[model samples]
Target: MVGVAMGGFCLAPFAGPVLWRLLIEKMSWNWTMWVLLMFARVTVVLIATLAETYKPILLKRRAKKRGLPLPPKLPTGEALKLVVMMTLQRPFAMLLTEPIVRALSVYMALVFAVLFGFFEAIPYVFTSVYGFHPGDTGLTFLGIGVGLLIGAAIFMFLDRTNMSLLCVFQCHRRLNPDCCQQKSERWLSLPIGLFWLAW
Candidate 1:
C-alpha cells in the first residue's frame, strides 16, 4: 500500500512539467498560476477540516480500546509549539544518534541532488542538443517516471516474497529448529537499483 502510494507521488516530477506546460498553453501563465493557487487553497481547506475532525475521533477510539481515560488536550498554541519543536529536532537527533538514519539521510540527499540536476539538465539537453521544442521537452522526463514505477514495483514484489518466505520458514522451524536461520533479502534491490543508476 505504501509502495503504491509512493509510486503515485513519484509521478509528480514527470507529470508536473507536462501539466504546467499544457495549462500555460491553454490559459496564459498568469491564469495558470491563479488556477494552481485556487487548487492549493481548496486542498488545504479540505485537509484542515478532515484533520480536525479525525484526530479527536482517533484519540477517543484508542482510549476506549485501551480502557484508559481520554487524553487531555493541550492548548492549541502549546500543541503547535510542541509539534514544531519535535518536527525540527527529531530528524537532526536521529541523524546524530542513529548510524542507519544518518546513512539513509545522506543517501536520500544525494538522490535528490541527482534528481534535481537532471530536472535542470534535461530541458537544456532536449532543447539544444535534440532540437526539441520547449513544450516537448517535458516528455524527456518520462524515463525518470518509468524508472520510479519500476523501482516501486520491484520493492512491492520483493517485500511480498520476503514475507511469504518468512512465514514458510517459521512453519518449517517449528518442525526443525534452526531451519529458519537466514537473513532477509528484501533490501537486495536497493543496492542493485543504485548500481543501475550509477551505470
Candidate 2:
C-alpha cells in the first residue's frame, strides 16, 4: 500500500515534464498516453498472475480462501502514520552514522537534479540548436537507454571485483566495514551515466 502510494505520488511530480517532453519532442500526446495505458494494462496482468512468495501473507490468503476469517486491514490513519515513520527513520539513521553515505547521497542528489533538468530542457535545445523534428528529438532518448545498459554492465563488473577487494582490505583494517563499497561503486556509475545523457 505504501509503495503504491509513494510510487504514484513521488512519480506524479515528474509526470508533467515527462509528458511535455514526449509531446514536444516525440509522438503526439494521444499516442504517449495510449502507450502508457497499454503498458499499465500489461503490468496489471503480469502482477495478477505472479505467485506470492511471502510465507505469512500467502498462508493468510490461503486460509481466507479456505473459509477462515481474514485479518482486518489497518485503519487508514494508522497506516499512513506507519508509512511515514518507517520511510523516514532508516534513511535518517543511516545519514547520521555514515559519512560516506552522506557524501554520496549529496552527490547523487545533485546528479539527479541535473539529469531531470536535462530531460525537461532538452526539447528546446534539440528543436532550436539542431532543428530536429519532434520524432527525431525523441530518438535522443535512445541514447539514455544505451547509457543505462552500459552502467549496468559496469555495476556487474564492480560487483565481481568488490568481493575480492573486501578480503584484501579486510586483512589491512581490523574493524573497518567495506560492506558498503559495492553499493557506492554501483552508485558512482549514476553520475557518469547522467554525464553521458547530457552530452
Candidate 3:
C-alpha cells in the first residue's frame, strides 16, 4: 500500500508539467502519449519481478522442486473453497463491521479529495485573498510541490523504519548470511506487491 501510494503520489504531481511542456514545445499530443507509453513499459518490467511470497505458496513450490510427497487432498475440496471464499469476503466484512476501518476510510477519502481540490482552489485563493495575478497564480503551487518532495523524503524514513522492524527478527537468528538476506527480502516482498497491483 505504501509503495503503490508513494509511487502514485510521486508520479502524479510531475505529470501536469510534463504534459504542459510537451504541448508548448511540440504542440502535439504525440509526445504526451510517448511519455505515457514509456511509463507503461517500465510497469511491464515490474510484472516479471513481482512474485508470490505467501508462505504456503513458497513451501508448496519448494516441496515440488525437491520431489517431496504431498499430503492427502480434502475429499471434496471444500476446505480450499472455504479458504478462498473467506479471503475474498474478509475485506468487505471489515469495512462494514469495523469502526476503525470506517473512520480511516472516511478520513483518507476526505483528505485525498481536498488535496486534489486544492489544485483548483489555489488560483482562487490567491486571486481573492492575496491578490495574486492570473499569471502569478502558478507560483502558489511551488510550495505544494516542494511539500510533496519533502513528504516523499519523510515517507522514505517511515518505509525504512517499517522494513527494519520487519526484518530485525529474521536477521538475528542466523548462522548463515544468506538466510538472513532471504528473510530481509521476504519482508521487502510485502511492499513490492503494491507496484504490480498499481500497474
Candidate 4:
C-alpha cells in the first residue's frame, strides 16, 4: 500500500498535463481539473481491493521457531536518530563514494532540469510557432510523455541484463586487476551518453 502510494506520489506531477490533455480540449482549465478529480475517484475505487502485507507478524512467528527473544522497540529519540542516520548520512556518504550512484544522480538531475525547461518553453514555443491555445499546447506535452516512457523502457531492458559480463573475464573468478584498470576506461560511456543526449 505504501509502495503504491509512493508510486502515485512520484507520478502525480507528470500526470497533471497528461490528464489536462485527455479532457475536453476546449474546456476551461477548471473543468479539466474537475475531470481529473473524477478520474481520481475511479483510481480510489481501483486501489481499495488490494491486500496488505504484515511483515512484523511474520517476522515474530519465525523468531519463535528459532527460540529467539522478541525484538525490543527502540526509545523514540533513538528511533528518530537511527532513521536520520540511515536515510540522510548513509545516502550522502554513498553519493560521494559510489561512482555509479554519483553518475546516475548527475544524469537524472540534468534530465529532470531539461524536462522542466522544455515544459516551461512549451507555451512560448507553441504560441509563437503555431499560435496554439492553452489546451492545444497541453497536447504537445504528450510527446515528452512518450519520450520519457521510451527512455524508461530502454533503461529497464539494460538493467535486467547481466552487465557484470562487461567487467568480468568469466562467471567464476573476478577480472584481473590489470584488466579492471583498463576496463575502467569504458566507464566513459556515461559522459558519452550525456554528450549524445545534449546533441
C-alpha local distance difference test of each model: 0.64, 0.62, 0.61, 0.63
lDDT of 2 by residue, 1-199 (tens): 3223333444444454555455656556687677678868998998999888999799898988899987788999999988887899778988989987787688658756976877757766788877987677766655554554454454444434553466455643311221234457665765786675567
- Higher-TM-score candidate of 2 and 3: 2
**lDDT tens per residue, model 3, 17-117:** 53444344445657677777887899899876899889877888898999997666666688877787798778779989998678767756754565566
Ranking by TM-score: 4, 1, 2, 3
The model with the greater lDDT, 3 or 4, is 4
Give the C-alpha miss distance for residue 17 in model 2, angstroms: 8.1
RMSD of 1: 8.3
Question: What order do candidates take by lDDT, descending?
Answer: 1, 4, 2, 3
lDDT of 4 by residue, 1-199 (tens): 3223433454556656655654556666588868768988998987797555579877888899999998998899999999999999999999999986787688668656755665677667777777887667777778767754554454334334543454345632222221233565555655674565445
True-vs-predicted CA distance for residue 114, candidate 1, Å: 0.7
Supply candidate 4's per-residue lDDT for 176.
27
Which candidate leads the pack in lDDT?
Answer: 1
TM-score comparison, 3 vs 4, better candidate:
4
Question: Which stretches of model 1 miss by more than 4 angstroms?
Answer: 10-57, 61-71, 75-81, 163-199
Q: Please, what is the TM-score per model?
A: 0.56, 0.52, 0.51, 0.57
Winner on TM-score between 1 and 2 is: 1
The sequence of per-residue lDDT tens digits that candidate 1 reaches over residues 63-153 is 9999999878899999999898799888778889998677667766765676676677767877887799877775666676667667657
